[model samples]
Target: MASVTFRHTSVTYPDGSLGLADIGLEVREGEFMALIGPSGSGKTTLLRTLAGFITPSQGEVLIGDEVVAAPGRSVPVERRGLGMVFQQHAVWPHMSVEQNIAYPLKLAGAGRAERRARVAEVLELVGLGGFGSRRPSQLSGGQRQRVALARAIVRKPRVLLLDEALSALDEPLRADLRAQLQAMSKQLGLTVVHVTHDRSEALAIADRIAVLDGGRLQQIGAPDELIERPASPFVARFLGDATLLRGRLENGLFHAEQVPLAVPAARITPGAPDSTQASMDVTSASGPASRGPASSSSAADGPVNRNAPLTGLLAVRPEQFRLTAVEGSPADDAAGETPAGTSPVNGGAGNTPSGGNAADHLTNAPSSRDASTATGPGARVTSGDDDPPPALIPASAPARVLSSLYGRHSCSARIEWSGLEFSCETALWRPQPGQAVRVDVTAGTFYPLSAAGSTPAARQEGEHAA
Candidate 1:
């Protein structure tokens, strides 16, 4: 497979202040690698750097053994032997499909006959075999993008760079095009680097994902590897729902403000960072833990190192979990009871440990519902309840439903938790406005997230730091 490597890459904008830093990476040939993160994360910048549009202030970018770029030296965007598709498709709207696809060939001085033949091949390759005479506007968004793809590959470059080329399309269409991109890469053996801010998009298409935050590489690894095991709390939140808890590890168990979690002591644990004063937004209650260093995922092939040989954990993924109503009986407590901490995890938002066990601990004691009511740190149900507190909640009720949005086959409700309101996606059928209803999350779903930078709480502190 072709390998694209970056060594200590950094970029500084004209205005200055770290556009990108300490970037080092390797992407296998015929692989789809996504550089993902929030807006200022340098995903687009990284793509531009690799494509030779922006010169790195330091370090190098390489494709296989050849050095494509090194500091001030660049091969020139055109001569870089790379195919690039931009957010706008970069297609000549007035030009016919054949003309656009043949532009690269024409620039290379391919004869009329040769260019025509190559255009035919690529047009078909992009599923536009007979549409060569069509203009850009004559095609659908997907078609235009396909034409852009055809044009990029006409030269048969070693690497393809996509700068959110399909982000503008609807979700369903994007999914179809993503599969097309993957298939094209496999058949042609082309190495590609794609950039986007959408987490699900990146995870679905990437052979590996590089998490960027404020122009810095936060973490990197295959999709599942990064998702199920983010290294830092930041990562846990950014990847998706990360139910963070403020706690310290002592005596093999983890005790947050008061919640207890069963951490596999034998496996890697969240690095003991300074716990002097920590706060969590409680983004996600439970899910799988996250790890860093960009681990490879078994989803790409078969099973991965299922025998946990890794570390740097913080729960993050939703699929890697099960549900439970409450804590189970002692007979079922195989992980053993949490080493009760000095305080209990209480308070609606910012709860402190009261320093006593005799008090009602905010112990995530899921009520015994459906025998399956297991208990873990991410206990969802309030200790005493079974099924959402009997719909006593009304508009003027304790918890009022704020907004409702419909999804393909499911729906989500924005519930006011405490004085703060957040979104919770569910399949439950509930009414509008003044509707009072009880809500509950899965206990097993709430768990500790890494300290790595995930989505900030209601308020954040970071490069956007003050």
Candidate 2:
């Protein structure tokens, strides 16, 4: 097993197209790390750099403390002692499965008997035991992929690199192969760096995940850390079902043109003469809470001032918002009434509560919600039927349903509110096209972002496609 390290590495094309920028990371021996991001996010470039296919223009790349890439040095791909699996599978069609898997061993000048033994062992390892004599054209797509995987690992290299290796397979096949890959990595103590745009796949397979965007390293942490407490709006939106709103931070409140959102704290001081400390505090509804710094007041308090003029953004995940039907509104006509026990909150989206202890009262609730059933039009289901209704906080944003798409049990509704379109998930209840829905931005996980002198940008729907 071997470890990989990037020391402020960067890669830039001759035409000034940046591929990677000042990335520094460390992957421990036998660690499984996933690189995930949108298109043009440098995930593939980073993987290529590790495999010695692309040399860095600045800094260095190391594998097991040996410099493989740097400004003045380069290691040939073959001498790096690594195995790579590409998206195309790349199995030789004319060769039998055993021949293909043993090709690497033969090239390394292994004895005939040893090559045969290793081929047979790996054939069984990838579940192709009896199919070793079959040609690539005679096997299914999944089987062909297995052959390619076996070929990559036949020589037992120090590291394994997968660049969208499973993107070409169907969902069921992909799942099966993913499980196999994980098992193989653990069983062989292999160090792996897998790259893909699928956040869920990365989360499910990797021990640690690194998120990159625009050729820059955004965040690297465990799956839950990135999902629950993202360091940036881009990271949050890219990794999960999030709705980002452009707004400003003033007195610990997020103020959009037509929405009122509250966050745990304001950590950015606009044009401040002095620097302030920043930290992350995430409290999931059912999961354990995490905070970066110690505090007596609340986990949300940070170094920035409570009252400052800072333009920024807010990221609210789908599960963070509690959907409620707006009462006495034009769009409410299409909304059904609340169930007998549930109660509707007072006021519109703009009438949200300001700072003070309101942030505390609004954010703390049951850690989990029970499944709820929809009974009437516009009637929103709380987390569970037994739990009392959520506190009566005004709507953070009032929206009109533009369209509703049903899934197996949940529904995704395209809502228009304050000139912004949000593809947020709601309860299984199907709302009419014009139905009124009030979104409550619950306290604990509402993330407030400072513009940091950047442009107003938000992640669009379906950015997670692999």
Model 1 C-alpha lDDT per residue in residues 1-466, reported as the tens digit of each score: 3578989999987888777787888898788899988777788888888888888999998888888888778988777788888888778988999999999899899999999999999988888999999999999998998999999899998889888888878878889998888888888988889888778888887889988776666678889767654644556667855544334322222333322233312122232122111112233233222222222111112222322221122332332222111222111222112211101221221121322111111232233333223354323323222322223211122345577676653345565534444444433232244444433222221222223333232113222110
Model 2 per-residue lDDT tens digits across residues 392-428: 3223656788887876545677777666566665553
Every candidate's lDDT: 0.57, 0.65
TM-score of 2: 0.74
Model 2 is weakest, by summed lDDT over 10 consecutive residues, at 457-466
- The true-versus-predicted C-alpha distance at residue 379 of model 2, in Å, is 17
Q: Which runs in model 1 stand beyond 4 Å of their true positions?
A: 247-400, 428-466
Q: Provide the TM-score for each candidate, comma-separated.
A: 0.66, 0.74
Q: Which ten contiguous residues of candidate 1 have the minimum total lDDT?
A: 334-343
